[model samples]
Target: MNTDSTRRWLALGALAVAMLTIGLDVTVLTVALPTLAVDLHANTAALQWFSSAYTLALAAMMLPAGALGDRYGRKKFLLAALLLFGVASLACAFATSAGQLVAARVVLGIAAAAMMPLSMAVLPSLFPEPAARQRALTIWITSTAIGLPLGPIVGGWLLRNFWWGSVFLINVPMVIIGALAVLALVPESRSAQRFRVDVAGVVLSALGMLGLTYGFIRFGEYGWGNGLAWVAVAAGVLLLGAFVLWQRRTAHPLVDLGLFQSTGFRWGTALSIVVNFAMFGMFFTVPQYFQAVLGVDALGSGLRLLPLIGGLIIGSRVVDKALPKLGTRAMLAIGFALLAGALALGALTTVDSGYGYTALWTTVLGAGMGLAMPTAMGLAMGELTAERSGSGSALIQALRQAGGTIGVAVLGTVLATQYRSELGTLNRDPISDGVNAGVSVAHQLGDSAMLHQVQTAFVGGMAAMLWVCAALCAAAAVLAAVLIRAPRAAVGEQQERLDDAPHVGQGADASESTHVS
Candidate 1:
């Protein structure tokens, strides 16, 4: 209960709030998209940009941002990011046109890019002890998970009671509180070497991620056969390759290329990428089933998803506790197995499938999602040092968001293909077609018979897509098994290291007690 300890705890809380705000913004805007389109007189492309623009900026800027924080000071950058994020939120709230909203979101994305990785980087400095760090990380991650469940509900409620801009406005108060707290409580931490920002690496990596994401999105809309898609993909690949080479050569690279030497960082990042691919795909697809197939409203759609939210929290907590006993490999393996099994079981769902029946498997899938994300993220942070932390932390988050962008792009492509294939075999028009094609097809039909057919066909597609998710998760499990370090050793090493140091400037009594004990 000394000054430093109190400040550290308060700073952690503030970062947790920042985490909630960012994650909440991700989904809050989703529920309000239709209203936004109506008010702005926007077309489909503009609506796509409303969402994609933020994600694109987030993905592109994260790595470069980390290097910038390292070169400058993390605390300075974090505070600036928070203040600017609030300003951008207000700008977003009053956006009169689709273009105006997109511009504000880009600004928000740049600010968000700073907040996220820096939050991770800041934690170790706050709680240097291994146990303390783990607990802090758990709280930090849990805050993020809480946002996913609460976001749509809050957004829907706000939309029901207020204007769509209310969703963005809600961010105003949180940002103010977070910025003030950070200024008061957080201690500044930095690298030993005075690192310079990797300007070339930044440019190449940014272009690479942006191109890759855009290519996937466009590919979803216009098949891979499109010459533009091929060209875009090639450019993305070439740019990424160049970026990697640049990192290897640069003295103070945007990211530390050597971290890939850690099997944990490599596989954990890979798993995060795939999990997001599946997670966002599921998040979008389920609502369609509830609203279009089950004929539920927005509230009902979100409510039905609660089982998923609940199960995820439970499963993740279990993994957090079990990791000490079961190790990284075992937890990731079991987690992936649960997801694949649930996805395979999901293939059996029909339009007639009751929530009672489908709930358990989807719940299992939720558990799998919950187990995987924080563990992987925590491990990624664990593997980094203060020197590489900013860029390394940024890489972890960048990959996940990139995973989301890629998922939307890839899953969107998969769905379109399956939908077309199913539609061609039917006698219905686009507007009249019921959900049909894959596990996803059990929705969207106002017509009963058409609904049944769509359900049947779409279930087929959903099954196939889930099969892909299954394979990816299963593969990630194998990768984690081979690549991630065992937890027993990691914990022991962290404890031994922590034992030698003062607990992040905790009270002198705590350090004396650790020595005496």
Candidate 2:
């Protein structure tokens, strides 16, 4: 390759490394949750917050973050974000309390919000050719996927040898390397067209998501009878409705309402959200099931996730070859069908089901995600013009993040509620805190019956949650088959069409234009 080509690919690699950190943060904490519950004295609600806080913040700030990067400079904002991410990771590692760690995660999310959109926005500047841009986009996305499987393994090793905090500490070196690489390799780029920041929209979206997530978490902790939880839910719904109205009327909307007019964009985004909802819910519960119920250590639990990752890799490869022939509608239906079947099988898991059984369903689950996620993303992204790519990507990402956040909150609540009900007046206060806590207490008191009860309760709750996910995927399968129309042209042709459109940030060199892919 030529020197310029080598430099561009290297720049893409830097962005990929940065993207890897954000992806790692999504799942690394799952394996550590059991340990956190023990060491930090966290209840189930607190555990939910540990994940939700980050995602909620990401969803809330992503649109604004994209605008900021456009107004300032993508490279400058991205560098600032990386630095902040490193500092937040350190804070998370050294946190003395669960609340402190949650606070730090919010900061990490804010930094990640800036990093995610801005990194993609800089892509066109590095690779101006359509084919090269497509290749770069694939590399960027694959980096994020690669982090999912690595998260458990890396986090497991850290927690096994070091401490619960080491999982967060691991991000430090990666952030440093990514930041330095980005500074050296990536060029600064910004849009020429200035836009107003939507302050009210940001506040409404943030508060609405927080209210909804907190309401579900509260319901999980205190049950459906809590009037406060109901109030929060109601208020959140109202706020979100207001947000949609504001988006339609505002001259400078955070999200472009016009994108939803395309059938591909709408269904593609919806299917992606469905997949994320199921995926996040599974991630939330399975690690706990491995450690608390099956009596595996963190390292063992992490290793167990390898089968799922393997399946995901295989599925993505298969879909990549098959998508051109089969079309998106058929692929999506097949993907969601696999998802439903696998999750249904998982729902039947018993305490004595063994690792082989868990491995079987999880592999299938990962394959389903592999098939659905990429196809869905491509379908949505194909609809964007070069001019709207940055904001459009932000909107899609924010919605997916929000969906995952809601999934954790709702599915976690489902598990907690069912577990508490199954416990049935057996010193419910301590036991209902969490399965891990209950198991620990039972062992300390040498109560075999209580241990059995806690394990059984947790399994029951997990099954219920999986059943809900299975039903959703089944519905999505039917919908995908019926609702998603075949594209008139191939993805390559769509990309060519996008290239034919007027580029944003005109009169700038390839290294300095703000035209996103």
Candidate 3:
């Protein structure tokens, strides 16, 4: 037993637990959204912000945080992130007003942005061998995945038995545990390079992400023709373009623009964007479908989602075994194909589709996600050096997050568009009466049947949306094929010793010993 590698394992276990708390927070709060909405008397926009704001902040800050982690020390940044995350969570528990809660959530988001990337960033420093590194990442990925489906299951139980704030409170202990363990076990590592922090890059990226997210969100409610939505979209495009241009001219760019020049990294990044587009799209609608349509309470909805969760767990394990054999390109293709079919099957979804049917399709979609997501991530992470991992991982996660948000914006738009179309055909003015027909249907017809129409329209939208997901995944497959260079035995034999790693319902690795089949 090598003394150094063993310590990395112990340190990582602790860090995984700490990071898992943030991962769980993403999905855990999702199930509690309805409860928060009712108890706080918040409207739909507030509810959307309740979830979206955290993602927005996380996406915005991740690259900067990653860079900061490298320049400073990953371990040091990780500990600080845990502390801030814990403190913010406590504030969230006590929030009285919607404004206060949303603000706290944004703060929490910033803290989370720090945690998500740095945790994985420190991993390579721990186990220098591929075998152990892949194993460590598996555990790390598994811990985060464990928190997801359990969020609603656990949050619902807590909400049913206690209060909605109970969810945030649970994070308190996890943070304490994470901070203490990191102090005891994790050693600090960062880039030896003296890279300047790209403030302009940071600002432009933030503005662009927020603008696009806001534009999509506003469009969901106001329609494609809305002036404000178009403004948001245009502003987002221009700002993001400016950010890219600035990066090229800068001496120390926030992200190495050259990384994308690598076809492997570029394709891997695209793979990440597409997978999240599908998974996070599910995150937005799954809860509503189960609660509003399936006529289930939060817990029931979470439980019904077991199929997808179960599939993910199994797929994660399966992919780990397969990666050495299938290679990243093949695994991604297989994964995306399964998921695309699941989305198509979702087109047949009905109000009374039954959990069996729902479970079947979700499982298929999830299995594909479990397979494709990690393989691509491994490729992306592998492309970076240890010093760059913090920034690189953050870039991957941040862009992936942005993709998830865009997924919700786009898919939610589809659902809303379909819903409004259906309503227009009905010639109904229920909404004009200051009544939510969707809400009223929930009470009178049982949320199940009413939810079916919503689900049907949603699935119909998603069916088409799923094709986009498939094409993206397929495109990623081709990109991986044409662009991704296999490690030359001479150059990469040692490095391959580590290339290999998955989930966060709210959010959120590579290997050589085994080919990613």
Identify the leading candidate in terms of TM-score.
1
In angstroms, the error of model 2 at 34 is: 7.1
Query: In candidate 1, how many Å is residue 392 off?
Result: 0.7
As for candidate 2, its clashing pairs are none
Off by over 4 Å in 3: 1-3, 38-45, 422-424, 427-436, 442-464, 467-471, 474-517
lDDT of 2 by residue, 197-239 (tens): 6888878877776677667657655667899989988888899
- The total number of steric clashes, by the backbone 3 Å criterion, in model 3 comes to 22
lDDT of 3 by residue, 477-513 (tens): 5655565565222125326423332111111122111
Best by lDDT: 2
Q: Considering summed lDDT, which 10 consecutive residues are worst modelled in model 1?
A: 508-517
Model 2 TM-score? Answer: 0.86
Instruction: Give the TM-score of each candidate.
Output: 0.89, 0.86, 0.86
The predicted structure with the larger lDDT, 1 or 3, is 1
lDDT of each: 0.75, 0.80, 0.72
Question: After TM-score superposition, what is the CA distance of residue 369 in candidate 3 from its true location, in Å?
Answer: 1.7
lDDT of 1 by residue, 1-517 (tens): 9988888988899999998999889888888988988999989899888877887788788988877776676888899999989999999999999999999999998899899988887887788776578768877877786687578888888999999899999988998889999898887766555556678998999999888877776776666678887787789889999998887776657776666766667776777777786677677567666765676767667777787878787876787688778766777777777777777777566767877766787788889887777777766666665555677788888878767766776776675556556655563455323352322332433355555666655655566666677788778777777666655666666566445534332333311211111
